[model samples]
Target: MYVAVKGGEKAIDNAHAWLAEERRGDTDVDELSIAQIREQLSLAVNRVMAEGSLYDPDLAALAIKQARGDLIEAIFLIRAYRTTLPRFGYSNPVDTGTMRCDRRISATFKDAPGGQVLGPTFDYTHRLLDFKLAADGDAPHAPVAAPRQEDTPHITEFLKGEDIIQDEVFSDDTPGDLTREPMAFPSNRPLRLQSLTRGDEGFVLGMAYSTQRGYARNHAFVGELRIGKVSVEMDIPELGFAIDIGEVELTECETVNQFQGSKTEPPQFTRGYGLVFGQSERKSIAMALVDRALRWEELGEDNLGAPAQDEEFVLSHADNIQATGFLEHIKLPHYVDFLSELELVRKLRREAEARMAPKEAAE
Candidate 1:
């Protein structure tokens, strides 16, 4: 019997309660502290912050704990909270040229103006797990370096000197926030980068990998990859000028892509940029490759009908929260639709059986 079920509110409430209980298993055992998660499980928090488009590490860490270690769910929490925040102002772009970098490296040149500092990378670490860490072992301190205030230069500037790199003109005009506004066709560089930074890391990585696998093989060299803190400045109308609001940690990657110069310009290396919220090199690198692939049209290259070149496809499917939520939502009740399909199938079968029986009798 087909019966109408009308307990949507109760079902939702029950689901939420179950989720809360699941999030806090064995209540007698000590609940995970946000600080503990933030300090110990910092990488998870970092991913959340990077994907969430928020900079607060503490909030990201808290969200991680509350979401029961689901990075995407933690990101969703941070994103939702970010919407309620009242933005006082925007920061004047901190010149990366003036950044006090913690880690900076260039694959293009063996040595650049800012010497390559491979600070705190797991690149050379052994894959074997340390059993000691399972018991929450304390980390050791490294020898402290002398504090110095020195401005770091971008590797691209060196190419600029030789006129080998494409000219990058900075505009004093402000860029719109993609999250605040509905994305339109032919997005500007700012919007495109914003969408990519908050995009699904795996999706972006796969799209980038596709380009490498001959979908649209645009040779890319890591012009520069830097991770560090930068001060955010904002203009205060009453103060008549911009002031430093705060500092944020960011992972920025810039790739020099092999692009043939257009008819209007001389041959020079073009740039694909990726800047994310925290220490996420892989995401940033993937973002750079996808960024370059998306620029095929602007670079006067053939579209080649590649998925990477399709802006709508890449941008629409890049957010995991949106994609997963829509995908998982199918788990919700759909008995009415299923019943209708079942009835149609039965009717079709009965008609076929009647036709066959009459033909047999006639024979």
Candidate 2:
């Protein structure tokens, strides 16, 4: 840990005040409200919530506003705020099977049980600027569709029905929480998945992309990608029953990977699962790919020595908050260390010149 020594409290205080005023942009323009940011900048808020590991949109929005749209800074703010919150007992695991899906699609099949519901997405849109937004004009009203009354079953359930895909194994043991306990090496799948879900989006995305480019490549097909709300429940000890505490929107991705069986088992398609707090499909998909890559040992695959496959490597560097602190700390004053190094270099140069002087006289 690096400690930076400093003085000038008045200067620091003045700088902070100026920074706050600067965040207001111009005095002539109207200030942005938290509600406006929560609604208008929904994607940014979602990203902050996902990375911050906090599910509160309002708090995420406030962080974004305070950080002046710097997402990493916003996530840092939310994380700092999260520590003060009171802890309640953990809620029961959410069941994605009963999700009221806003969007659902399966890449493996041309047409699946739940036909693709294309919600608000930029996937198909051409890269073009909307000059209309410049004129302060409202967007055209989006065509409203009737919400489906029935809960949509996961697309993987059909693949599982035929007994083709490998079954997802589960244990009754409670998984470790990284927030509460320090992360240990040789992390279990539960802990790894937990890290990936809350990991930095860019870092995880790059690691996931590496796998696609043949670094421990595991050919994965998006068996199903669904985004919707799932209810969070908590059991009551008094009645041996559970009550619905609340619901949270989530993106769940299940990747089907073709595997050539090892000596211990027969060849069967395996699954990689990714679940996160919000509609973060990119992160979810990346999490799935990296999740699959990291499962090399369990699947009896060779250790390809890839970054994604390294448990400690990925988990250690995945946290943006931690990474930012270490990286940004270097920018703080290190004048004492620099001066010592500078003197050492000068001494070495003088010694080299002294040795060269004798050689020159002899020549």
Judging by TM-score against the true structure, name the best candidate.
2
Off by over 4 Å in 1: 1-5, 8-15, 27-29, 146-148, 262-265, 359-363
Tens-place lDDT digits, model 1, residues 78-148: 88999999987677887666666778999998877657788788878897897887786577786667754
What local distance difference test score does each model get? 0.85, 0.90
User: Candidate 1, after superposition: displacement of residue 65 in Å?
Assistant: 0.9
Worst 10 residues of 1 by lDDT: 1-10
**C-alpha TM-scores of all predictions:** 0.91, 0.95
Candidate 1 residue 87 C-alpha distance from true site, Å: 3.2
Count clashing residue pairs in model 1: 1
Q: Give the TM-score of candidate 2.
A: 0.95
lDDT per residue as tens, model 2, 234-299:
997886999998899999999999999876667888888899888899999999999999988888
